[model samples]
Target: MPLAVWFVAVVAVSFALAYLNSSGWFWIGAGAVVLLAGLGSGAFPMDLFLVLSAIFALCSVVLGVSPLRRLLVSRSLLAWYRGQLPAMSQTEQEAIDAGTVWWDGDLFSGRPDWGKLLAVPRPKLTPEEQSFLDGETEQLCAMVNDWETTQVYQDLPPHAWQFIKDKGFLGMIIPKKYGGKEFSATLHSQVIQKLGTRCSAATVHVMVPNSLGPAELLLHYGTEEQKNYYLPRLAKGLEIPCFGLTNPHAGSDAAAIPDFGIVCKGMWEGREVLGMRVTWEKRYITLGPISTLLGLAFRLHDPDHLLGSREDIGITCALVRTDTPGVNIGRRHNPLNAVFQNGPNWGKDVFMPLDWIIGGPKMAGQGWRMLMECLAAGRSISLPSSGTGYAKLAARATGAYARVRSQFKTPIGKFEGIEEA
Candidate 1:
């Protein structure tokens, strides 16, 4: 039925019910009818108005409140109804467009010639970055050809890894003093998107180091020595770093205690170094099973307040080597999502000096904040880039296949469905 007919029938029945003094039951059914008609109409939020009407009817029944009286009260349902009536008001005019044939509803303007739809302008690339992107594309094409033949996708090919490293791709966002490319955030996104079109695995591996590694933390709070040491290596890909944030006890809880054991009672003599045995069960780490360097976050149990006077405080970030004593590297698990490589990374009572702290010793209890900042920037690029690139590639592949493969005595591309009409 037409929306106007339904709405008229509803209002007529509601008036009859109100005249017969059966406002209670009548309002309920009338509100429901209005809500359904409004939704089907898709002209505005009619459901909200219906809900308010129902609330007013209920208030009148329970509190002996008249509809007019309810309207006078602050935050009354009737007030809500009056406020929303403007949203439903519409002027009679034809909202026409060049390619449109008819009005379907307010949801969308129909266009018979969809090809003529205006597209947003693509971003113009900078000169140096454009040159780099062209070079990378050629390099990646070569790599993909070799990868297809070799059945060896366990790790990046040496030449591919070398190419990325030589171009300072890993250090694009890292501080320039640390031998980084120091490219803008937009450039980083573009490069990652380009890589995603070719292979997702390589893109993620490159992203993890560039975005989530110790460089982000160092740039935020690392000591001069720590920044000097790690940033240069990270840019050169000499040190592959992974974030160790999620734990078995704290899957999504940022405030959970990680349970680091205290082996010795008294504080260490003649030094600010405090010793503890950290026992943790971590999982879902990007490079946990294979990282050479780890940016680990664990809870500290400072009894005597040696490390800036706190006990059972929140988590802290540490730059620990994977090869350190008592650290356990679990076997890599097949994630079923062919791209991101992740596995269990557990540790047993790992002891380290105070210098192991990211930013030397001052960056305690600030790991979660740092992790959020880095991961936020990382996600903005990684997922979107991969999805867009894959979609574009799939579209290209489908178009080519449709052109070559034929049906109905002609190439499928020649058909109305396949061809741009």
Candidate 2:
């Protein structure tokens, strides 16, 4: 390129970098423009340009051949950009709060403790657990003959639902003492993974209750009386549970949910008691249509300071029966043709006793933290397992197809591109 063209190119790059709000890139471009201008004005020899070109080429080679590119891009450049950016969203902050930071150091210099990583316990299923998984696997495969054809209907067949309940698939995460299988996290993931390979819809049906459902919340936070009343029923599949967390206004910002409850006297079980009158509108609730019980989260308010001096007690979680008066359920949403019973549920003036709180009155105002903690574990196990199952299924089917499918009188698998895939 001519000297004038080089000068214009450098000036254009500087403006582009400034437009992108990249201060670092703008400075680099400005430095290059100054060098080019000096060379064009005959202030620097042609040999100087040759020397600079060689230096740039050597730097490029070093960056391409070593880990220096990633070190600069990810660790240095990206880290600096992140520092200048706005604070992370509440969901991201909560996830970080829920997570553990074991070691702290730079990426390149950090030494991970291999012993600690290897010592992490693996999940083992007992004889009964293994037998249950095998039986359920066979049962699911038989019921879900063709997942594509099954999607023609609105939902899973009645027999399929009955089979799931009868097999105790909904209560896998609950404790054995509570009449549940209480399978380990590893076993729970494995069961979901295996089921997902056969039918994605069936996996959701079985995975929901074992994941972020009332069974988990009640087990972790329910009072003894609450446990006695609900655990056995949940274990026996007498109750199908769904949690109400995501609302139309609050997709991921659980802390900012507008659905609320007011402290007041309310009728419960045909008697008056100091309870909450909750008003909520939630969408994207999994199993909202068929769930017999709804695990609801809402901000608790006390206009008259009924609970205490504090007017607002932050976010609270409660268990509301779907049959409760003023509660509207049964709205369905179809996402990606998955047969999961997901939809919106709303209530005008739903009333429940104060004891209906998951951990009872004492656990009020702790719902956000509780939900985050549960999510930390669920996020690590359930979805990742299902995703892995799908990947494995895709790999198997693709490999088989590549082996048999012909292209140019030869198996497609023989192609370099096909082999790379």
- Expressed as tens digits, the lDDT of each residue in 1-109 for candidate 1 is 5567766777787788867777455566666666666666763466766675678566655544455445566447767778877553111111111123332332363
Candidate 2 lDDT, tens digit per residue, 317-339?
A: 99999998889985588877677
**TM-score of every candidate relative to the true structure:** 0.64, 0.74
Stretches off by above 4 angstroms in model 1 are: 1-126, 145-150, 248-253, 256-272, 337-340, 407-421
TM-score of 2: 0.74
Q: How accurate locally is residue 171 in candidate 2, as Cα lDDT from 0 to 100?
A: 84
- Report the CA-based lDDT of candidate 2 relative to the real structure: 0.80
Looking at model 2, residue 227 earns an lDDT score of 93
Residue 356 in model 2: shift from native, Å?
A: 1.2
Q: Give the runs in model 2 whose Cα sits over 4 Å from its true position.
A: 1-111, 145-149
Clashes of 1: 0
